[model samples]
Target: MVKIKANYVLAALWITLLCSCQKRSPEIPEIRQVDVLIVGGGASGTMAAIQAARMGSSVLVAEETPWLGGMLTAAGVSAIDGNYKLQSGLWEEFRKNLYNHYGGPEGVKTGWVSNVLFEPEVGDSILKYMAGLEDGIELMLNSTLGHIEKTQKGWIADIAYQTDTIRVETQVVIDGTELGDVAALVGIPYEIGMDSRHLSNEKIAPETANDIVQDLTYVAILKDYGKGTDMTITKPEGYDPSPFYCTCAGRCNQDSIGRKLWDCEHMMGYGRLPGDKYMINWPIFGNDFYLNVIEMAPHERKQAYEQAKWYTMCYVYYLQDALGFRHLGIADDVFPTADGLPFIPYHRESRRIDGIVRFDLNDLARPFAQTNALYRTGVAVGDYPVDHHHAAYPQSEALPDLHFYPVPSYALPLGTLIPKSVSNFIVAEKSISVTNLVNGTTRLQPVCLLIGQAAGALAALAVDEGVSPADVPVRKVQQALLDSKAYILPYLDVSPTSSSFSAIQKTGATGILRGEGKNIGWENQTLFYPDSLVSKSALQTGLQDIAAGLVITSKKETLTVNEALKVIYDLMKLRPGDTHFSSREAMDEKAKEIWKNHMDTLMDPEVSITRAMFSVLLGELIDPFSNWPVDHHGTYRSGIN
Candidate 1:
């Protein structure tokens, strides 16, 4: 972690206060600064701050809202992605907290893909606790970013309030703001609306592209316990139930953003409270704050946002009165302010980075074996489909079904997180480079948190290693990820000495580093799809299937340690740039040394012969891979050992 000057820190926080002092309020607190200035305390921004602080750096978060945890907390939505499997680290911790409160693990049973429904308050407490642990993480809420400029030493973030303006000159500036507003303010190249071309060749992209973008939503909390309460809520300014809808509230369309508008389907939804003993997520007010509010000027945006809040409050009144329910309240305890107005105004599109590598929809559906190039630099796996949400269908339409293209859990490149012009800055939110269609799926809360963790980890690596983020070696990045228990590279639990890997040699190879939809049968059999589940059965089956596929030249009396080493060396050799061995010559050298050492140990009977010993050695010797290989045409091509 780099040491920041005290004066520079004061400049960053005060810069915002300074900007605010000119207009409305008179008295405001002085500003404070830290090493890294995060503009948004949403999902990604929070994760970035925590990661940086964990690595021993000074970090500060400037949130426009009072509370953190953007969508999960402020939005009052209980559902996470349908594909939040392989839960670990920050995400896993979030679940643990919910389970602690709910008294049982939530969600329908689906092996690892089980959904974890939680109350908004629990989510808020958990996220705040996660970042609040570090003394170095300073939170400056109700502060707004006014501008960002690159100085010789590093970068400075200008934040403002009604009475004061603060400037934070830090080594790194992360644009975790939901709208990617910070990136725009910093002069970063970004795409605003839908992509001009169907880069992903997605079925949902319009035949004729336009500047139209997806609408936002303002989710409200509701409850019903058969108690007594007044709940007749007033509708929005233009809301009409008789002719309800312009856009599909419950569904999504892939193509034609210009044809979409907010509908009534999702205007108010119901779900089980933490215990599944009550009702929740009944959006009776604020038809859609995140959607229409983007078109407003700053003050107008604030007004629209507040109006949505009031509308949502009125909606709760409507639901209770209409349904004749007794037990229901606004749940204002969650947001603390805005009268239970969600802490976040669900932002869909933000300033996406124009990086060296771009992931389009076409690449996702391509045969994993054919487009293996996509995995060469994979840092994380995404088994979800290209989820796209558009406007224009009511609750009666099949709008949510258009986004059915399943993509593999492929590697995300380090390059994609780095901004082109801003060297120290990284865009961890949906702001990372991708087509709008791709952004639709990736913008989910879970994805943002995980990607933010990865980005934060990389930023930590850069700071710790005294190198630019671009120069952090790939292998170092992978190791740091592994150390943090993040799953950028999938791991197989096998034992040559134990029963886990009955046939050690065959079970240890990686045909596709991808999970779920890794271009199934396009080259090899790597099953992948949106509805894919990561079950214990799948893990066992994949291990056996790939092991059986290995070509054994000769059947000897028994598999020796020497022979196993050769096989291990060859499997890792499919790609030259990987960790174990980069070249055939190097592989042979390491194999010789390993074989000799094993032979020497075997020659001595005093050496341990227990299965436990063999298993430990096998696990240690197994090649750990972070990504797969692709051929020239960018196909998921693999060569057998």
Candidate 2:
């Protein structure tokens, strides 16, 4: 009878296979091209779309997930751990929207860097709002890229989603995907393992080399009500067979009780919830996915997630099931994924481009003024210490909370983002050009956004100009970013000034332009440093200071006496123009003659400024043409992206 049943089972299996083979072909959607195509809709992709849209380019952002904001919203991780220099453009606008809607930073007087605590939904609302605020930005969610091919036109992205198969054409593409999938698809050369050596040379890395990277965390935000409920999760299948927790006393930094408190007992994470007391996205529970999370078969993927889920569920069960802890519950409902895990894996590494330029710790430690190309391309500012983390390393042990040299202002290179062969595609996550080990330094969210802003602005400009991203002039892009108020360069200009003064003096004082006097390094509490490059906005204040001083009596120029007299007469009669002489066309001929006369007539020999006398001389030189390109006062204006 058993043998007969086996024969029947084989017959049934063959019939199932036969039926599956008879399935019809799916109706694929027609392909469409775009000026700019972004692969992911995370923080970087969202910002890129904003840039392209503002530049008046038709752009499409494709995301596999349901929402936007990669680590910020999707991953349910809080706190933008990064340099303080993150505020401008889409980034600034994002913050403003958050502040306006949530009243977080908007209520504060100064919000250069406010640690605004909020739920993931807020981030979701804000990103969606930004995408809507701009035109020409199409966000295609649930879209998956099947394959990418480069043709004579540019590149073609073959995508499949839900019940449709479509193709997208674009001049430029951005690989904002979390895993660097676009780079891999486009054949970008990149490194995967940790550097056998330190970031630069053999300075600080471990002697031996390894390929396995740092651990990933599945984060979620849970609230408590101070009263126990049925919010506990049960142990997953194959829980006991898992070897993914910190086991060694040395590694875990726990004797026995600590381990029991977290592992065996699990009574640690419960906080005053319901009352909204604490937010949990801690490192208390770590899953062992590297050892067990692989998908050899379609069904295995579910098994993998189940294991991870069990790890998390068992974590809470240790609190509720084993410890009978009160007021403790899992917030898994807040971020449930298709596999019932957190929306994101908190990945530490994906794909790093091996393109034009590669950044290493050596670049940071490369002794300033000792490098080129890389040093010249700084678009943002950062001073955070190099931070790296891995699971195999004893993360549970009492760490020194190590910190390395503080990098002031350094340029993040273009090569790091662009793939070697793909001209249009760029990356702006922790998965840029770096050995997996170096990702430790670049993974910080703020740094990621800094990279994102630059990539976004560049892609936007490329879309607007109908050119390859490689062809866009970096300087013009820099200027546009500067105009948008994004922090693209070093923060060397921050002082008082006004449009009524020449930007030359204000900027010269701050530092960018070379000056006659030495860089006295501003120890004098009374004197404004002449070498410092003051912000363009400050020029207005500087002009006001100058206008207030009595030095306005002006016996200025030591030019040809007759020329000076003519200049004085012209100045007395010429109050009717911008830039001192109509900067518009039709008046170009007149402007040219006036410019020549002005240059020849007023060659002031000596320019002087006191904390007091400084203002008057500045004003006299400014108000003449303060509304020009550099502003009437000439102080360099700046904003952040």
Candidate 3:
């Protein structure tokens, strides 16, 4: 009996040891090394990742939210604000995908405020699909940046991804966060809220600066469920309908006569999305909430966002109970949250970094006439008017009338993406170096996309060339963007589809040929009249900067083919080449040979040369832009200066 009991004890101890060995230990955090580390998976961050990956660099995107499209998708601001006609780069690709999904452009034009409107989930899915197609991108959803340390070789960042912390070592770090959090973490200098007139040098700017940013909105997607469905949500805490009474049925000063200018139906139809839904992001006495949570802690920000969400819920209640639209409720199938609200609030402004160059109102109003020629270093373009939302502020009435400041379509300089103090860093989204006034326009959807794309290209080029972002040649970055079908010059007339697009772009960058910019109502323009005849004085003005001794002997106003050949001969003298013709006849003979080899049509020496023809010839022959390198301030470093 004692021997059997001892055997039983031995068997029990062995079983216990086996059970202890089978138990799992705590998981260790992973350490990932990548060429480019994008901090946020927002609009610009996602574009930056895709662009960097497409440029043959391994990229990792850390997005706090599960979705990618920040304002366009997660924030539920589905209606595109601008860039309806200026679809370039990834923005054009994303828009085309949207058109494909919705059947056509006509299918998504369900809103009166914008030409394009779709469900937020659809935008998120499209972005995910676009990002997924790139093999070089690795996306970490539900990830938040923890600690960032700049090393001698690159940057090391600790990102809280899902249930574990991930250490990422990258050569380039892109701050694509909605609020520029990564830049702030690295102790980079940035500006918040308004800039004084003395600082910004805008005639309309206020004398004193303040911490007053644009009102952010927590957009909610409401769907129409039938008249008798009773889709109205439960009354929110501290719900009051009195504040929003004036939103739909009230007499305002804008109306010359004392009359109700707006109705509930018209207000709802303003943001009506496809498939019988509403965006619920109205501005005037609507859901635009006043809060600056940029400096708040994570928990503090969440608490603040809850207040904004409740305020939006209050407005929704007002829409249903007071306005008699009881059938419209929060769209249950839109978001992954327990509540039907968007994943994040629509932030209209962010901490603007102090970059190598500061893009201001003057840059937009008169791009070509700037002191530094900032237009020559453009990487992204925007045409939206300076639209600000400050109705929620008490001193909003004292602010300058931004609507009076009309600006032509302008290109954002590449220097705006490179921080002056930080190395190997690029800022995208709304955090670029632009004045508060310019941010109102650059903060739009399409411009942010292009800006993100440019940031990606700059980061990728810096990694591939083994140089800092600031050290990368501005022309090289611009050329890469052009190759990606992006606009370095905001020329409305000449598009990426044009055969002479690259040539015109290169020539325009060199200031050898300039476009005329105009501000017509809401549609700003920079027209490059490709078919117009090249004038002698215009050519002389353009060539004076590159070719110092070139003189136009032709007495006619418009330059002919013979005169153009002589000018090309003079230009050839400045650049080193074997085809340095001794006389106009010899130059013409060489030009004919070159034209036959390059261009399709026969060379005619009698016909007047058009702007397009001259640009193509200059691109093929001299390629002057390659020789001239512009500095951070857009000043030419070598020839022109």
Q: Per-prediction TM-score, please?
A: 0.70, 0.67, 0.92
Task: Give the per-residue lDDT digits (tens) of candidate 2, residues 1-641.
Answer: 33433443354344224322322235645677788888888877877777768767788888776667787678755455544334444566665655565444633222112254445655665676667666687767666888788877678887665566667888888888776767776777766645656443535555555554555555545455367466565565555522424532223546552442244222232222222422333343334334222112325644554544555555544445544543555553455564444565566666566755566666544413233324334444344455544432444243322233334333455556666566767777766776544566577665666667777777877767767676665444555555556654333332213221233332222222222211222110112344333232233333342132212233432222223223323332333332333333323344334434434443232432222222222223332223211211122233211
Which ten contiguous residues of candidate 3 have the minimum total lDDT? Answer: 17-26
Clashes of each: 70, 48, 0
Model 3 TM-score, all chains together: 0.92
Pick by TM-score: 2 or 3, better one: 3
> Model 1: which ten-residue window has the lowest total lDDT?
521-530
Candidate 1 structure quality by residue, lDDT tens digits, 359-390: 76665455333333444444443545565544
Candidates 2 and 3 compared by lDDT, better number: 3
Backbone clash tally (model 2):
48
Candidate with maximal lDDT: 3
For model 3, what is the alpha-carbon lDDT of residue 637? 67
TM-score of candidate 2 versus the correct structure, residues matched by position = 0.67
Model 1's number of clashes is 70
